[model samples]
Target: MRILYFAWLRERIGISSEEVETAAPTPAALVEELRAREPRYAAAFADTKAVRVAVDQEMRGWDADLAGAREVAFFPPMTGG
Candidate 1:
């Protein structure tokens, strides 16, 4: 799976994206897997409430299924100025 991090998430994780091999069934599960990887990932995902997710470029909730997802993006909510 391809994971993309944006905004502060990328800054905290120290990477823009990565190709991961995971058997996670949901975005929430994927988060737990990533959080277990390292301190950076743990920190980045520490507060999921501040983040939003997208599966295959479509916005999705944390519990959303990831069965056929090829790409997942994590980013903070946008603000209109």
Candidate 2:
């Protein structure tokens, strides 16, 4: 799957996006796998509440299924002035 990071998430992870190969069933599971990869990934996903997810461009929760998903993006919650 193609994983993308936005806003500060990209900065924190030190990359905008990357293709990941995993057997994770849910977005949360994917996060766990990423967090276990290195310190940067761990730090980037330290707070689940502060982050939002999109699977194939549709907003979804951490428990959202990743079956056949081609893209998954992680970003901070949006704010409007």
Name the runs in model 1 displaced over 4 angstroms.
none
Q: Residue 70 of candidate 1: its Cα lDDT?
A: 100
lDDT of 1 by residue, 1-81 (tens): 999999999999999999999999999999999999999999999999999999999999999999989999999999998
Judged by whole-model lDDT over C-alpha atoms, candidate 2 comes out at 0.97
Minimal lDDT window, size 10, model 2:
40-49
Q: Which ten residues in a row have the lowest lDDT in candidate 1?
A: 60-69
Q: What's the CA RMSD for each of the models?
A: 0.5, 0.5
Estimated TM-score per prediction? 0.98, 0.98
Clashing pairs in 2: none
Error of 2 at 75 (Å): 0.4
Task: Give Cα distance to truth, residue 73, candidate 1, Å.
Answer: 0.2
Error of 1 at 48 (Å): 0.2
Please give, for residues 1-81, the per-residue lDDT of candidate 2 as tens digits. Answer: 999999999999999999999999999999999999999999999998999999999999999999999999999999999
Cα deviation at 7, candidate 2, in Å, is 0.8
By how many angstroms RMSD does model 1 differ from the true structure? 0.5
